[model samples]
Target: MIQTFAFYLFAVFTIASGAITIMARNPVHSVLWLILAFFNAAGLMVLVGAEFIAMLLVIVYVGAVAVLFLFVVMMLDIDFAELRAGFIKNFPLGMALALVLLAELVLGIGAYRAGALELGVPDGTAMAPVGESNIEAIGALMYGRYLFLFEAAGIILLVAMVGAIVLTHRPRTDVRGQNIAKQIARRPDEATVNVKPEIGKGVSL
Candidate 1:
C-alpha cells in the first residue's frame, strides 16, 4: 500500500530525472538531474530493504561525486558548442546503445517477474535480526564476510583519486625549481671562496 506508492513515486522520479540528465542542454543542469536521479534511486533502494546501499548512494554519489562533478563543471572553461559539435555524428551510435539497453531492461524485468532469478533468498543463519539497523547489519556483513572486497574497493577509489590528481597536475616552466640533488652534491669549495686582506684594505668586488 504505502510501500507500493512510495516505490512507484521513486521509480517515476528516477526515470524522469535520468532522462533529463541525458537530454538537458546545459551541462550544469545535467549534473543536477543526475543528482536527482541518484537520490530517487537511493529512495528505491531504501524501499527494497537495502537501506545501507541507499545511504551509500546518497553519501558517496550525491555528497561526493555529484558535488565534485558540479564544481568541476563550473570551474572548467568549456565551450558548450564545441562539446556538442559531435552530437550529430554520435547520434546513431547513441540511439543503438539506448535501444539495446531498453531491450535488456525489458528482458530483465520479464525474467524477474517469471522468477528466473533466485534473488532475496536467505543464506541460512547468517541473516541479521529483523530489528537490527541496516547500517549495523551491513557493517557486520562487510567486516565479517566481505572485508577484503571492501578494503579493495577503498584502495581502488584511492588509486582513482590519485590518478585524477596526476592527470590534472601540470608543472610550470616559468617558476624556478630547487635542484636538491645539485645542492646536496655541491662542495663548500665550489660554493665559497676564501679571501685574505691586508690591514686597512677592503676586498674588491
Candidate 2:
C-alpha cells in the first residue's frame, strides 16, 4: 500500500515538474523545475528496482543542470537588487520545498533498506547469479556484451566536444583585435581630436 502511494506520488510530481520546466519563462526557474523533475524521476526509478540508473540520473543530469543554471544566471543581465529581494522573499518557500524533497528521499531510502518495496524481480534471460548484485550484473553486461558500443559512444562524445572547441576558437582575419601595447604608448593627443564645426553643419570624419 505504501509502495503504491509512493510510486503515484513520484510519478505525478515528475510529470508536473517536467511540464513546468518546459513552460517556465525564466531560465533559472526552468532549471530549478528540471532539477525537481529529475528528483521525482529518480524516486520512481528506485521504486522500480533501478536504483543505479536513478543515481546516474540524479548525479549526471542534476549535476549538469546545476552547472548550466550557474552559467545561465551568471551570463544574464539580471537586476541584483531585485534578485536579492526575490531571494529574501522566496527563501522560506525554497526551504520548505527542500525539506519536503529531503524527507521523501529519506523515506524512500528507508523503505528500500527495509525491503518493503516489491521492486519486481527481473524476468529477463540475463538474470544475475544468486550472490551477485544488480549493479554487478549491469557492469558485467556493459563490459562484456556492450563494450564496443560503449567505446563508440565515448568516441562520439569526444569528437563532438572537439568539434565544439574548434568551432568556437576558429580564427577570423577580417576583424581587428585590440592592441594593448599600442594603446599604452599612444599620446593623449592621438586619443582625442579637437574639431570645431560650423553651426548647423556636421564635422568631417
> Clashes in model 1: which pairs?
none
Candidate 2 C-alpha lDDT tens digits along 108-148: 99999998876877777687868987889999988988899
Number of backbone-clashing residue pairs for each candidate, in the order shown: 0, 0
Tens-digit lDDT track of model 1 for 1-205: 9999999999999999999998998999999999999999999998888988998999999999999999999999988898888887798999999999999999999999998976886767677868998789878888989999999999999999999999999999999999999999999999988789888998876
* Predicted candidate 1, C-alpha RMSD: 7.4
Question: Candidates' TM-scores?
Answer: 0.70, 0.57
Q: What does the lDDT read for residue 69 in candidate 2?
A: 82
- Whole-model lDDT per candidate: 0.93, 0.88
User: Which consecutive 10 residues in model 1 have the weakest lDDT in total?
Assistant: 117-126
- Give the Å error, residue 75, model 1: 1.5
